[model samples]
Target chain A: MMEQSKEPLLEVRDLRVDFRVPGGYATAIRGVDLTVGRGEVVGLVGESGSGKSISMMALLRLLPAAARVSGIARFDGVDLLSLSPRELSHIRGGRIGMIFQDPLTAFNPVLTIGAQIVEALQLHDRNLSGKAAWTRAVELLAEVAIPEPGRRVHQYPHEFSGGMRQRAMIAMAISNRPQLLIADEPTTALDVTVQAQILELLQRLREELNIGMIMITHDLGVVAGIADRVMVMYSGRVIERGQVDDVFYASRHPYTRGLLAALPKLDGAREALVGIAGTPPSLINRPAGCAFRPRCSHAEAVCATAEPPLLRAGQLESACYVSDRLSGMTP
Target chain B: MLRYIFRRLIAVPLLLLGVATVAFFLSQTTRGDPLSAVVPERQMNNPEIVAAAKERWGLDKTLAERYVIYVSNLARGDLGTSFTTRRPVSADLAERLPATFELVLAAMTFATVVGVGLGVLSARYQNGPIDHFSRIFALLGSSLPVFWSGLILLYLLTVQLGWFPGPGRLSAHTPPPPPITGLYTLDSLLTGNIPVFLESLHRLMLPAIVLGWSVVGVITRLVRSSLLEVLGQDYIRTARAKGALEGRVMIHHALRNALIPTLTIIGFAFAYLITGAVLTEAVFSWPGIGSYAVSAARALDYPAIIGVTLLGSLAFLLANLATDIAYGLVNPKVKLQ
Candidate 1:
């Protein structure tokens, strides 16, 4: 396990979000606690509607008005949720940047690529002139490895290819030199080869700028190489968390083990791939205790009676009642 | 872009011709003698007078022959003389065209400015008091008939409170300014006649508001719904994430996309206003093409009816062309070619 000897750049504690639905409130994120040191990459892995993205969005207060978010997100010694909207706006793009899943939809169709980048730059820096911002935008585009930045900067979003648009999205995100970045499934919509390039670009940027990043994705392979720590979420709750290497090789939670087993191996004897048995429980009226009990192969009678709190065993923290017994077994 | 515009312009005459042909045949279907409009009721029994009047107006020709002659005359830019007015239909329409254009322009401007403003406000504060009030206002505007609303407003504002002019484009004694654009307000401004300009605007207020009320409802609903949809777009989230203030996020990112669909509705609304001004014009006694068309219809003046139909079709065709060009300009994905 990596030692946390230094002050964390971002520390989130007991983050919760509930959405107002037709009849009653649906708790999307029950309670999520995480910390990211400077220059560290944290991977949040979960299925769709698992509240992985919602937790990050809640930190930035980016969710719709229907969502009721309550959380303590401390960034650079400031409590983010307590700040006024005007004060929060400065921290949003100035200190903490975010890039979404779909770059094509993330960009305004009418505005040029350069204009969007310039907007981010100028929003944080009041004295920056338009011409200087444009020049800086082109430089940022080039920094993201986009070719012919001079000509491409003036073109509209629809004129660019999907990969190029994602590159531009990255360019805009990092334009302000934010200290922390939240990338929500950034490469999910990209091609396989393009995905590698984007991941590489993100790693290089994080290294050069020493910015802490939270990489959210559903694919286990996506986080295997990039993240320093891996957090596995199921049914809106974090089921397991540990150093990336330990979690991959010695995961304790049944859900995490199932996810790792579901990954297709490049070199192995041919065999049928295994998938988790059941779908996630509905949020409105979740099962009495463990939300994943129905899908868990190692579920016990105690799991249905009372929810298990996250218990630490050396380097890993797991929320399963049978995690201790399962730790002794092998694949 | 130029090529697209040129192609659209080329179709204008063909569309006008189609409207003209339909109007001609439809007028023929109405049970009426063309010569009765010109010859007096007493003179209708006199065979010599009726024959001479029929021959003079070419009503004596067979239907097919007259159609051929009508088409040829239309090709030469000649709308047949109106049997009721004893004047060329083109000349009469030319004189009234300016009045209708002025009124429609004023109403459209009013509707667009106020409607879009209300829509933006309503969307910005969804479920708020402002949103509720604007929605109720829109509902009433769309549901209430224009003539009834015009009369009510006229009585309340003009008769009860005496806050605005009753009706007409100007007071009874005011001589119209020199006809530069034939729009009283513009002409008065051009001639540096501020009093005349204010007087023309004063008289223009109530009728324009009454005419534009229904359109305002449509525009508000369209813009409100469109803006609400755009607010949920990914780009809007990106803008907000970029530290843009709520105002800047709305105006810079959301409004542009929201207004694209609204522009199409506005185009059709403008065209509708031109033709739909008939009832509004009657209430106000405004000397515009709509009232001219009404009078022509009553007299069964086929030539005048065809002329007005051509004008209405032209307005629709031009509005559609303008909308297409606007779409190309605002959305980069739209290829003009």
Candidate 2:
């Protein structure tokens, strides 16, 4: 089943990013180890300020000037963190594609969608120009299923509807045909029908292009529907990692269990949504033991005193003291 | 677009009417008669001569009748006659306008180029020494008086160093260029008189710097704040994420959006330069509308005073129209209402 010999497209180990604040530094991403093999979708789930986006942004070194990032992130056997800005830029849009949320603001209002896509393609490959770039842009727009690609390509961002804008952003992202795609909340701003369509488009692209993707979202339902593997984050740490079926059916972490329980059940009688009480801990002064101890209902003396490692329990791994008891909870 | 322009142009006459009525009433309502400066103090007792003088100047008519005559004459392009010089007000204004236009253009170009450069530098190096320098420079520009700066520039650059001629349009030795464009530089260039053009440009530099400094301050501060805000936007981040160079992100993504808000300031800045040119002209002895107004004000010349005010009002109206057009051009999202 596993493609054992081929290296993963992108592998990140012990990646840490610290943001210098007014006093000290706030560790936004702490020791996040993730690997995306070719043709696999890894859904990273976390609430707000959970470092889901930070970890992904760090892979490309896209944080602001004040951020201090550390650790090794290797892509195709090359160290990403050590690459010069010029070389890293080559790898950014050339080898990896990125799509962001809020496509309205993500697009430059002054330029046409086709122009932006052409710019993306040109930035990666300097030789293509004029008719060639224009044709490639039209092809990208058509790939995203936008109608009348030739006519619509000339319109500015304001002329596009929200769903159309997101589609255009997707076209821009996939313009270079990179091996890996990092989609950060790609469907958050979309309506239900549009969200489904975008998700379907993503699935179709993943299969046809055989591109590894890291989908960052807070929606567990989205993770369930499309993600091949799931990695749950809390504060600045990834607390659990497993196959989608393993994590969905036999969740081993209390935090993951809390997230799964909070979802509104569609199959049975509608029950009150179970929200995990307590807000996420501030990363500046992270909780001593486990970052989720304050919110975890199964917290014990060990859970409050010492942090647990993400050790393998057969087919899955979770950072918790009482993983055995939390593993068998029915959704 | 045509409708939008027509909507803006339609207000011009209404605004002119309001300005003229207010200017006439204000002159009448002031403490002394405008004719007092012209007539001798010893002739105050001669009621017959005074009534005759009033009739000649149309001052003997009722306020309503005088206003109607003023509007009708204005419509016909007659700006009346000056009380002191006994010349057509329109001719004098026409003679002086080119000087003011030349000064305003030079000052605007210098201020915008240098000030926007400083704003961009400060924003790029935010919280650094460049930012601090730009902030302090803006503070001095906005606060320092124009006449005071004009004198300081004169003392340092002209009087001390003896590098530039002190004030006026040209040296007494250089003959006036043929009046092709009215502006000395253009007229000199058109007439192929390089010496006159150089002298006119030389004399203009000091006052232009004096008038431009404050506007530079305003532009720098405006560009800095707006650029900083734009740099933080998600589009800028997206630009960087797309593997664009840092320079491309700043120029293509950030600066274009930041320029929209700055355009409004530029319109008002041009109007302010025209008004400030008055004080600057009075100090520098430049032969412009401003100096003409000052000399008229001293002599209580009602026609010249009214003419100057009308010119300024029109300049401002035109500037506002230009700003609206530029606003549309720079920002495609702004569909004129």
**Top-scoring candidate (lDDT):** 1
Clashing pairs in 2: none
TM-scores, one per candidate: 0.97, 0.96
Q: Give DockQ per model, in order.
A: 0.82, 0.71
TM-scores of chain A, one for each prediction: 0.97, 0.97
User: lDDT by residue for model 2 over A32-117, one digit each (tens)?
Assistant: 99999988999999899999999899889888889999999989889999999888888877788899999999998888888888
lDDT of 1 by residue, A1-331 (tens): 1454476989999999999999889999988999999989999999888999999999999999999988799987899989999999998888999999999999999899999999999999999999999999999999999999999999999999888999999889999999999999999999999999999999999999998999999999989979999999887789899999988888888888888888887897698888888888888989998888988878889999987888896579999898888787653
Score residue B258 of candidate 1 by CA lDDT.
Answer: 93
Q: Which candidate is the best by TM-score?
A: 1
For every model shown, the clashing-pair count is 0, 0
User: Candidate 1 at residue A125, lDDT?
Assistant: 97
Worst 10 residues of 2 chain B by lDDT: B30-39
lDDT of 2 at B256: 87
